[model samples]
Each structure stands twice: as C-alpha cells, then as structure tokens.
Target: MTTLIRYRDDAPQQALESSTDGAVIIERLAALGVGFERWSTSRSPLPAAASADAILAAYAAEIARLREQGGYTTADVVRLTPDHPEREALRGKFIEEHTHSEDEVRFFVEGGGAFYLHIGDSVYQLLCERGDLLRVPANARHWFDMGPRPRFTAIRLFTDPAGWVGHFTGDGLSARFPRYGEPYAGA
Candidate 1:
C-alpha cells in the first residue's frame, strides 16, 4: 500500500491530510509536478541479482517502457537490508534537502521508504511500498529517509547513466519533518 501525508513544514507532528488511496495519492503528487503510479510484476518476488547489469536485464521490458516514457537512459536496482554497514551513511546522505539536475525515479520492488517533498508552503510525505513508482521532477526540493532499520529493494531509473548527483539546499528543514517508520495502513 502507498500513503501520502501532507503537513506544514513547521508542524510536522500533525498531518494536514493523509490517505491510502492510490488515486488520491497520484492526484496530490501530480498537483506538485510529481508522478505517482502503481506497477505489477509478472513474479511475486523479483529475482535476486548480484549486479546492476543483472538486475537491469531481469527487468528489461519494464525498464524499456520507463525509458520510452521518461527518456531515462539508465536503470539499476538498489537493495539495502537492515544489517548493511553503510546504511547510516546512505541515509545521512539523503536526509538533507536537495535537488537533482534530472528527475529522480524509483520503483519499490519490496520493503518500503519515504520521500518528503517540500513544495510551496507544505511538505508532502510520501510512503512508498512494494509496487509503488514515484518520480520527482528535476529540481524538486526533497529528501529521502530509509529509516533507522533500512530494508528495501528499489529499481531506479536515471536520465543520466552516471546516476544520482544531488545539490544540497543547505536548509536543515528535514529534521523538522517526521521520519519514516510507521507501517502502511493495513500493511
């Protein structure tokens, strides 16, 4: 399931709005120039791949469709488990508000994560679980939190094959926002 929670950046403890409905999620994100969609895979659990090339090859058709639709040039899988030693570093890297030159797109294959987008006067906290696909437009102000116990498998589509490069905004607003942790409604 996917959840969208809206809040005033300064009042993160209280949600202005929240929903588990997919249509509503898409509509709300779309209004912010972001894209949200649900996708299905032929298999229940995607095949395990040790390398980016293997992962890309495992989902070639899906990658091709995304590439055609978004002009993405690269596709890769990122799997992080709770025991990963670098989880803290990776989480810290994205905890600060930042923007990318190209759109940041991710498809969650398993587990989940959250993307907090700061647009205008509100902060949109999007909790994405399995089967969820989210695309944050180029230059969108946002930060991602994989939580303290990181566990997720995501397929990322990049406009540049070189992959993720973020420009920090130097604003420490992320700490004011709620971190990812609560289980999706009904899990």
Candidate 2:
C-alpha cells in the first residue's frame, strides 16, 4: 500500500494528514507537480529470473522505455536495509537541499520511505511503500528519509545517469519537511 503524510517541519511526531489510499496520494502529489503511481503485482520485475546478460538486457530495455515515457536519462537501482551502514551515511550526506537536472524516479519493492518535495513554498511528503513509485521533476528541490531499520528495497529509475547527479542547494528548505522512520500501518 502507498501512504502520504503531512506534518509541519518542526512537528514530525504527528502527521496533519495521512492516507493509504492511492487516489488521495496521487492527487496530493500531483498537486505539487510530482508524479506517482501504483504498479500491478503482475508487472513486477524479477532480476533473478534472468541470466546476468539477460538481466542487463532487460534493465537496458526498461530504462529505454522509462526514458521514452517519462523523459528521463538514467536510473539507479538499490536494495536498502536498516542494517546498511551506508544508510546513515547517505542520509547524512543528503541533509542539504538539492535538485537534479531530470526527475527523481523511485519505486519501492520491499520497504517504504518519505520523499519530501519542496515545490514553491509548499512541501509534499510522500510515503512510498512497496509497489509504490514516484517521479519528481527536474529542478525540484527535495530530500528523502528512511526508517531506522528499513527492511526495504527499491528500484530507482532516472532520466540521466549523469544529469541525475545532485547539485547541492545551500538553502535549508529541506528543513521544511519531515524526517521519516517507523512503520506506517502498524507502528
């Protein structure tokens, strides 16, 4: 299920609005100029089903398709775990605001996280669970925060591998959004 939660920048303890409804999530995100969707279980991609060469081939094909459909140039796929030491490091590294030349595409396959997009003065914070995806456009400043122990994996589709590169934004706009942790449904 996909989730969306809104909170004042300083009040992460309680969400002003939270929902697991896909329609609501999409509508809210769309309002901020962010694109989001849910994929059917039938369309799930399994890397293990193919040989190494075949996997690469499939990945290439998928990349091309996404590029054509979403105007993206490159992509990154990652499997995240709460135990990953780099998780904290990556979080620390991204504390500053930033933007990409192309949209930021991410599909959660295992775990969930909050992607906060700072569009104009409003902040759109999306909680992306498994099977949920989000595409934030070029020059959209934002930041992401995952749980303390993410049992999650995600596929990140991008428009430009290089253009997707981050340009550090000196502003503290990121401080306007929430920091994420904990389960959305049970905890």
Candidate 3:
C-alpha cells in the first residue's frame, strides 16, 4: 500500500499526519503543488525485469499522454535489485538532498520506493508502490530512498534531454530522517 507521512522539518521525530488513503494522499500532495496519482498497471504485459525499450513500449500511451501534458521529451526505465554491483553507491547518491532543473516524475512499475520532500517547514515522506505515479515539481528539495536491499522498477519521464542531473543541496537534513527500511511507521 502507498503511504504518506508528513513531519515537521525541524522535528522529524514525530509525524504530523500520515495516511494510506489514496484520495487523502492526492489531496495533501496536490495542495503542495506536487502531483500524485494511481495508474492502472493491468495493460502492461511486460514483466518487472523487462528491458527499458520493452517497458517503455508497454506504457507508450501513458507516456505519450504525460509527455503531451508536461512537455516531457524522453522516458526510460530504471531497475535495481539487491545484487546490483553498485547498490550502496547508488543508494548513497540518491539519499542525499538534491534538486533537478526540471520536474522529477516517476511511475512505479514494480516494488516500491520512498521520496522525502523538504518543503517549507514540513517534510513529506511518500512511499510509492506499484501503479503509483509521483511528480515532484522542479527545484523541489528532496531525496529518494530505495531501501537498503533495494528492488524496484520504475518509469521516469524527463523534460530535459540530458535526463537526471542532481544539484546537491549540502543540507545534510536527510541524515536526520529514517531511511527506507528503517522504523518510520510510528513517525
């Protein structure tokens, strides 16, 4: 199930709000200018381990619609398993707070991942499972955690042809928050 947890940026020890309801999550994120939705994953015949081209082809219609809506020019698939050779390094890179030149959008095709968005005085931690689509607006201060033993496949949409290029914020705020596999449910 998808989960959304909101915490005060200055006090990550407690959650101000947490919900697993889709409508509530959508409303909360939408109010903050973030786009959230649940897409139907039934049409894709491709498996989670399918090649990027195959995955992209399976979701061409949805991708095309998103491209038309967000002016996105390219789309791709990123898959990572626990045995990935650079799992630690990749996880480390993603756990650092950063911003992109264009909006960061992703649709989880398999497994799940967490995104922590630092906006104003709140930190919204969103767990995106299969069929969940999240779009963090451009320049949003955030970091992603795919868990210590990562396993997921996601479709990413990009407006910039250059693709994902993170501009590190060097805030070290992420270090204070619980990571993907940690005990954050109580918060």
Candidate 4:
C-alpha cells in the first residue's frame, strides 16, 4: 500500500496527517504540484534485461509516451538488491534534502522506497511500492530513502543529458524524519 505522512518540516517525528489510501495520496501530492500514477504491471510486460539498453528497449513504448509527455530526453533502469554493497552509500547520498533543476520521475518496476518531499512548511513522506509512478516537479525540495535492505527496480526519466544533479540543501532535516521500511502506520 502507498502511504502519505504529513508533518511540519521542523518536527519530523510528529505527523500532522497520515493516510494509506491511494486516492488520498494522489490528491494530496497533486495539490502540491506533484504527479502520482499507479500503472498496471500486467498491462506492461517487462522482460528481464542484462543491460540498461535492453531494459529501455523492453519498455520502449511506455518510455516514449512519458518522454513525449514530459519532454524528457533520457530513460534508464536502476536496480538494487539487499546484498548490494553500495546500499548504504546510495541511501546516504539521497537521504540529504536536495533539489534538481529537472523534474525527478521514477516508475517502480519492483520492490519499494520512500520519497520525502519538503514543500512549503510541511514534509510529505510518500511510500511508493511496485507500479507506483511518482513525478516530483523541478526544483522541488525532496529526498529519497531506499531502506537499509534495498530492493527495487525503477525506470527513471530525465530531461537533461547530465541526468540527476542535486543541489543539496544541507539542512540535515532528513535525519529527524523516518526512514524507509520503518513502521509508518498512524505516523
């Protein structure tokens, strides 16, 4: 299930609002200039690929539509498992609050993670599982946590050739917030 936790940016441990409903997640995110969509995995067949090129080729049609609609120029696949040695480094890098010049779009092909978007005075914690497609608008302050036991396959869409370039806010607020895989119910 997708979850949404709303809290004051300064008080991450105390949630002002929370929900596990999909419609509510979409509605809340949309109101904040973010886009959320749940795709049917059965409708889009994703073949196992050994290379990024093959992965992109397998989902060419879907990638094409998203690229055209969002004006994105590049598409790629990122897969990380529990045994990945770089899991900690990856988690640490993204756990810092940051913003990108181009919109950050990700479609979860498998597994799950959490996206913490700091907009206005509230932080929106989004737990995205398989089939979840989340688009964070350009320059939106956010951070992602893939959990300690990372396990996910995502298709990332980018507008720039440089791909993802984050401008870290160095606010250190992410440390106070809940990380992925934690018990977020009623948070």
lDDT of each: 0.85, 0.66, 0.89, 0.86
Weakest 10 consecutive residues of candidate 4 by summed lDDT: 42-51
Query: What is the number of backbone collisions in each predicted candidate, taken in the order shown?
Result: 0, 8, 0, 0
For model 1, the run of ten residues with the poorest summed lDDT = 178-187
Candidates 1 and 3 compared: the better one by lDDT is: 3
What are the per-residue Cα lDDT tens digits for candidate 3 across 1-187? 8999999898877788799999999999999999999989896546655889988887888899999999999888889898999999989887999999899999988889899999999999998898999999999999999988888899999988575799999999898887886766454
Q: Which has the better lDDT: candidate 2, or candidate 3?
A: 3
Model 3 global lDDT (CA atoms, 0 to 1): 0.89
Clashing pairs in 2: 72-159, 73-159, 73-160, 74-158, 74-159, 74-160, 74-161, 111-152
lDDT of 2 by residue, 1-187 (tens): 4667666555444556677788888888888788788865443455533343442343465557667998765555677666787877766665567888877887665567777766654455676776776887888888877755655566677655765577888877565444565432211
Off by more than 4 A, model 3? 185-187
The superposed Cα distance between candidate 4 and the true structure at residue 54, in angstroms, equals 5.2
Tens-digit lDDT string for candidate 1 (35-99)? 88887755547555446676566667777988999999877788999989999999899889999
Ranking by lDDT: 3, 4, 1, 2
Ranking by TM-score: 3, 4, 1, 2
lDDT at residue 133 of model 2 (Cα atoms): 68
**What TM-score against the true fold does each predicted structure earn?**
0.90, 0.75, 0.94, 0.91
Q: Which candidate achieves the best lDDT against the true structure? A: 3
